[model samples]
Target chain A: MAILNIEPNIAQPDDFYEALIDMHRDLDAEQSRMANAHLILLLANHVGDEAVLREAMQRARALVPTSSDVSTRPA
Target chain B: MANVDREYQGLAFDYVRSPDQDARVAVRHPVVVVGAGPVGLTAAIDLARRGVPVVVLDDDHKLSVGSRAICFAKRTLEIWDRLDCGDQMVEKGVSWNVGRVFFQDERVYSFDLLPDSGHRRPAFINLQQYYCEGYLHERTAVLPAVDLRWRNRVTGVTPDAEGVTLAIDTPDGPYALRADHVIACDGSRSAVRSLMGLESKGRVFRDRFLIADVRMKADFPAERWFWFDPPFHPNQSVLLHRQPDNVWRIDFQLGWDADPDLERQPERVRPRIRALLGEDAEFEFEWISVYTFACLRMERFRHGRVIFAGDSAHGVSPFGARGANSGVQDADNLAWKLALVLAGKAPDRLLDTYGTEREYAADENILNSTRATDFITPKSDESRVFRDAVLRLAKDHPFARRLVNSGRLSTPATLHGSALNTPDAEAFGGAMVPGSPMTDAPGTMRGHPAWLLSCTGDVFTAILFAGDRGFDEATIAAIRALGTDGIPVKVLIVTAAGATVPSVDGIDYFADDDGAVAARLDARPGTCYLLRPDQHVCARWRTFDADRVRAAVARATCND
Candidate 1:
């Protein structure tokens, strides 16, 4: 069995999304990035399992294109 | 149609001069309530019914101008039933139970507010706020102890340790009055609140909405329809509701940059209505106004001896219709305690519970309305994206349906974790726990049909459930011997056996042949629930114990 389960788990998904949006309401770009970093660190600490954290990071990174690939590709 | 139009102008209650205005000093009254709107009139009538004299003051001589607060919830109807005006409201209002939601042009999900049968009132009724005020005003006129004075504006309120003194301005002249307690039910722009230098603090949404009451003959079903980002109006919301006398209330959401004055003109408003109701809709405008709402409330509802109720105490966005409904409930929670305190039966500390409990309720209303408002009007682009995603997903998945927020309709706030509750000693199974309003069930009282809620009088009531075996002689005698301590406790015995018990003095019997009451209350053979004057459960037991009941009553009244 997997240690991390992330398949539509929240009882009130909209409330979580709302709170997340509200958290970033008044922040600038730098502040928003810092807030995201802090939030990730806090959530990672709560996850505790190193393997699960590594898997989450890999899954999150796979969704975005690499900077070098985007630079070399045509617009 | 003429009568409805005339009510908009208001039947003038001519300004009458009271002898108190000519007194040497400020004439002292027992209780003085400010404002003649639904909340104030409710408080006055409730107090007068309890045999406490109340003087109600209002700045205006007629009903309010527009049809504000069109939705009256079932809980409000129940409170009106206790106050003797529910029949009139139910008769004149348009009752509805079904509500539909639409994302873009396609229907998302529909809901039945009252899925269960056997309820006395429908889930909600759409009536003009003026009609509610008229019914409450008619009820107040018959109550001898309620002195409702029109055009009596309270300009100044001074509160000392003993009581509150007011400076009133009437058409005849100004007058000074004093009262043991003052209940302020003034509207959101409360002069009394400003006089005290207090303010309500909350987040104010930047968008404005146009409320138009259009008179037309149409065949739309009497159901609440809400649309989000429809083709008629893109990137906004629209709400359609049915009122009495062929009047339909349509609310069109305008962005923050829309001009309020420009939007009220017929040229602008007519096109919007025609856009939603087609070119040949044939409708005449009954009323129109542009309003911006905020979710805020006073820090405390009570300041010394002056208590604020209604919009003066708290306010919410119009999405949930929680404003006037919760205000009337504030009066319901307050009147009995004030009556008891005035009669010297309970200590003054009991009145403090009203402030705390209602403040807790106000916080809940603010939170819910704020959430609904946030969903309806997203502050950020990301938030709007999330909201649209929820609406889109709601059309397919059941889990996402719970995320849709089209104003959770108003329901009675359960006063859980109140200071007045007696902690339970035994395990209970249902929702009728301490500090919860008792659920209503259809039953028969002495061979006549009645509601279980109507059987509870406006006093401390002990609802005894006779499951299989009837009550013992000792318990019945103890119930008969109650109230020697000056605070009366009325007894209502509920039996599911469908047979009458032996008649005893000071005890009423209810036949629950369908056993619905038993199932709703989770009652057992010897269970007893102690209800406050407001019909909230303060204590309960699996077995009948008169001593425990007395202790709970004492705690409920803040005597122990």
Candidate 2:
């Protein structure tokens, strides 16, 4: 299996992070969550390699609270 | 200036009045085509080329009223080339392959449609639908086998086991006639389809669009421009294309609740046009129309002696320009099968493959068009959020740009799983797969420069790329022995780049020249290909044998 190659491959990493945050401005808590879910799925589909995608998913999931989804996460 | 007026004055062509109805009532003609539009005319012309007598009936003598179906795709052009009009169309059409898509107020990206060369036709051309019909009309006029009647409308159709009886309404009077086959080339609102109790079943899009054709003097390049939520057209999309005769076709998306009547008026639309093209941009309104469409197809395209071609078979939203393009394709796919069946060369079941293949294409067009419509006019907030995100990401990211499907431009449909196709029996590589239409390449025919596809109709063509051992007299006899009149298959021996193949009585010879044809087909010197009359591949192999070629030809004609 191929290892994940997620080491700041974007040309301008800081600008991409700023753009992601800017997308959520002026939105309520629920809208921000929906936008996050959409961005994840969009980026996942773009990175169609399944092994790399699973690695990215696992790495991101480790940072979030396991019980954080009980009340607020999208179904 | 070539006159393009607001009103349509029908081109003056000699309209030969048919003889008295009583005199021709009992004679059953070989083929009768209803609705002498582009599709019907193409079907009639192709049949006449194969020595089939055809009768074409049209309600009106003129071309289409508005500048509808302005984009002619490459495959559609190739089909027209077979009908003897593709070169003239490319000359008269405004050819372009670049398209720019804008999101909100910012230009997201631009793409080139045809990056490679050596093909006969370009990726796409913008020609008014009426001009297309006019070209078909002029070409059909020279063929005496086609009897075209103006002011004649097929009012009723009666189909039986062997033939069909038609009641046609004429300017002089109503007349009854009979034909061995009836091909309905009528438009989407097919009266013949309605008479058959077939309903075009699909959800009517709540969305509507306004199409305005304008003649203007502008320096903008001939490229397709699409906008999503521009500052001028707020909260809606706009598409602009350049057509021949200095005419510009523009489409504006209006919400479901927009008043169609008020939106189509020139006075109300001029300000919107001015906002996009500056206020001082002087332009004359040529035509205006409002359309709302659905993706629909008949349950079947064949009904015994009665067959449907063009808009009569299927229809889709106008986003991808699939309507007229697919209609032309429908005629191309049906004409050869009908000619063979009428000649008793192939079984009647061969006609069944026409419905199967074209219906497959109709489904593909509908699927793409419906997806495009949804992406352009997203239904809910959830969908719009993703659409905006994709558009926003596309500005800088290369991968995101490919996901943006304003309209996946029209391309040729592969007749996958067609009953008439024979899968390869030997090992091979790269294109020329069964059911794929053959790609065109520049080559020399006899001693003259020619496009390969322009030489491919009228009979089943087996292109034999002969190797060092060319073909001995016995081998040549084996190739000739594989065909009968019922399933006529002809061979073309394309020798290697420098080798010369001796020309025989009926076989055509061509050299690959710069190896473009061989490179395009990924073919070696020993490769052999069997193509249907319409230029779609039926089977291919690396070696040639008489028995295998005969079986492949038999399968292509459905001789069982």
Candidate 3:
């Protein structure tokens, strides 16, 4: 069986999107990045499945133009 | 400007002329302790208690200037109690146990350190470093063997085959003194360490912290409060602790680039205080300092006839309050071994254990303080992201709360796998392993109130558990013989709750009223524990055997 569900999982996708945007309302750019990081960690913990998180990470990394050299990438 | 608004009256020791200054040749002493800070004073008192004459020299004639180290842990308090000053420290200091952690504007959680309490001392006590040094210095007055020379400095050190000779300087002039052993207790910028050409090596943190002690009449509960990215001080962390005399200590995390000199000024500090407390809040500054700390230790604490203890040997950041607390523990671990060596009862190799054991403890402290420092002031963006994530999630999830590291707080390091310990031959369960310190429990002694620790005096103590029935004749005879042996061992017979025990002239008995002592030690009917002079358990057994106890004592003193 597949560990992660790639299907549309959120029942109310617009409500989830609205709440996520609302969380970053008064935050600056640096703070918005911090909030995003916090949200990722919280959701990852809530998921509580390593293979699923790892699969999600790989799928997400494929969408972005990642640098081949790890050291060259911004922290 | 420092300590100008202090409530406790500071003490100044008068610099008296030492008769050794006029000696034609250097007078030989058994042991000479350099520096008169908390560590040196404690070493002097311990040596004097063990019947060793120690000459404690210091360049200054007063206690520490400001309230540098305010958090004294339970283990340090017990060591002071053995030195005969724990009561004064606990009485004068503000004892506290609860600690609250906050994220942004909300308190995430609060923790009680001493949740179950039969301990004589609290989890921690916040007392000014000056008051602690004063109490320790005062304790040395009654010790006739302690030759505490004020305003006398160790200018030079020369080690040789027999002993170490120290060149001293005083207001009168300079003189030379010889000692069989020299214990360097002078702090971080140790003069003795430099004179010996030894260097402490480790990582240096590139962050600075500003500490301000403000006296106010606000009624905040006596608890440690820590905030991470609070609105009052955005992004950085802040720690608040209540000290005695209504004084509060506030530590603001300043990044590596902040100017230390400008940050400590009242004009710069006033706005920060006003932001934390309201603008109309009335407060007077007691002390302010901007300091950067490093986690480091010397390669070895022992060199030939000279030894290093306290901040002279190891140093950690103040986040965990491990610097002074660990230094005090170093003195505690070394004093007994040094005394035995001076008395010619233990082999010279025994002193090496002090180096190894406390070096292990130093590494532990350094590791903990370094981790806490990294969490408080993240070195990189990724680390900061993870730290903030933990702080944010800790408010709701218990698992995330475990990831939060404000400070582990100071706890005694069990000397696991120490050479002095006799390996366990029987199965046992408890925190009190062979190399662990004895846990304190409250009980009655001879119908009066007493504590389990108060019974373990400065000697080899064996605590025997008497379950329903008291000890047999052979066991009692063996304990008596051990008491009269070459190395006398004191016995404290612990009877179970309501169990009757016959009074013996030589051995003392404690009634375990609440069964806390029995539970803490995992004791059975004939279970016994052998504790060293410093109160660290060296051996234990399911049944008492005279030969095993004798051999264990020998091993503890490095006779085997």
Candidate 4:
């Protein structure tokens, strides 16, 4: 099993959005694709509502494709 | 006798009967700041920027003499940048990052400030205080709202519920003037403070220090060099700092019994300095003065409508170079408060924080200067023995080596008992609380470390975690109410997995980021943050509660 380690409990939507924008600005297209997926998932986990997390996951998946070769994990 | 116009700069003057003849002319301003020193000039500039009419008075006929405070810290430079003078000051100042200490002709320790990992500004810069004053004066002259009145003095000051009135004495004549507020930037012997019946309370050290500014021609390292002991001066030490104009500021720790008259004589002091140099080097003395160190702080920074700033409020030994720096900060702190109160943006209670906060900083500076003084001049025999032992140990121990090598020794100001600060149970546990000094991190507040973040589209929101599981829905609703009439809050709740959510304290429940969602929030749970206009923390809570968080925001931004 490919273990996807996600750090839970994202605080403050404003700060989360700022981090997202910063990552998008700082990272390249390929890295951003991978990072955005992780960010969305992390944000969903903090949401803690399983239904909301599922809906956010669908929105995130449409934005960035998750690949088997690539592991969606935080460094 | 020559006559000069005391009203405007560059205006030539005709002869007058006497200096008192010029004192008859009266000038009026909404706010009058006494003293044209660095603190007074800076306050005038800031107040002018806020469109407050100001008149600055100084009794001195010319700029100050000597190289009095040559060191400028980083935060001060940032403030200078706001005044549009940072680039000029930085260009003219010399940057030094390394320092060395010598004990008994042997180098005891050395340290490098460049490797400190993250510093927004340089460790230290050396520029003569005269240049700083001249730069500020030149800038203040261009500000139309600011009037610089040289050779003007306030002989008396009286305050009532209405405003502050000053009995002003100009070279032309004496006049009575009234101002909304009066700021005293006069030096340590502040006549304003004396008239206010406030006393500076602290210890006065007996030992006298001799500071000499001289032009030296030597191939010495361009760094702060200190000799702990000299052969001829067994108990005394020598301190040398390089200045911008190729001049050197040299200080000698003279014993308490040293004769001031003989020390002032070049014949006696010059030989002693020459002997330390080993070879007979030719140098010209620019200025020399003997001063005793006193760690004193005013009991209260304000009395009625009159406010005390800079040396008038506090005095510290020169060892840590905190005197001038802290004084400038006092001016910075007070100027903004006075401007706000005058402009009617904040309540009168905001002015109360200036005394509470600045007095705390003044006391901290006194403590640091006192420590430096005690280390340099051991008061008791036991302290002397211990200092000597530490110097000996510093020669070999790596920890001691690190301590001795970094020549700059001063503590950063802390926010405790500040009217702006709120109580935090886990403030020391790495949570970004309100009133803490701001740091430069991507998610942190820009100027202050508080949690005020604004999104790209101008939508503002705060983030809180379940650090103590204390927040509830009502509190969140209260904070959301602060949103603009149209802009609704998008709340995001962060909670630990498998842990029971605690009872609501006051925060509103938002969406949680758990499992894959956690990757999106990017913030740990149990952490709460509030952001303000510039995307900085207005307030933060470890546990959640809507009402408390909203109240904190209101308090910080003056909404309440």
Instruction: Report DockQ per prediction, comma-separated.
Output: 0.05, 0.19, 0.45, 0.01
Candidate 1 per-residue C-alpha lDDT over B1-560 given as tens digits, one digit per residue, 9 for 90 to 100: 25754554467888999999999999999999999999999999989999999999999899876679999999889889999999999999999999999989899998898997767899999998888898899899899999999999998999988878899998888999999999989989988899999998788889999999999998889999999998899999999999998899999999899999999998899989989989988999889999999999999998878899999999999998899999999999999999999999898888899999999999999999999999999998767766777787678766567778999889888889998999989999988989888888888887798898888858889888875556678877888877554787877889875565666666798888788888988887788999998899999999888888889988999988
DockQ for candidate 4, C-alpha atoms = 0.01
Per-residue lDDT tens digits for candidate 4, residues B140-228, read: 87899987777677788888898887886766677677778889999899878777777888899999878888877766776777777
Better of 2 and 3 by TM-score: 3
Model 3 off-target regions past 4 Å?
Answer: A1-75, B1-9
Native contacts retained by candidate 4: 0.00
- Give me the runs in candidate 1 sitting further than 4 Å from their true place: A1-75, B1-9, B483-485, B497-500
TM-score to true structure, per model:
0.89, 0.90, 0.91, 0.69
Residue-wise C-alpha lDDT for candidate 2, range B259-280, written one tens digit per residue:
9999999998898899889989
Clashing pairs in 2: B345-B486
Error of 4 at B398 (Å): 3.0
* DockQ, candidate no. 1: 0.05
Name the lDDT value of residue B442 in candidate 3: 93
Error of 4 at B353 (Å): 1.0
Which ten residues in a row are the worst by lDDT in model 2 chain B?
B4-13
Candidate 2 Cα deviation (angstroms), residue B323: 1.1
Shift in Å, residue B376, candidate 4: 1.1
DockQ of 3: 0.45
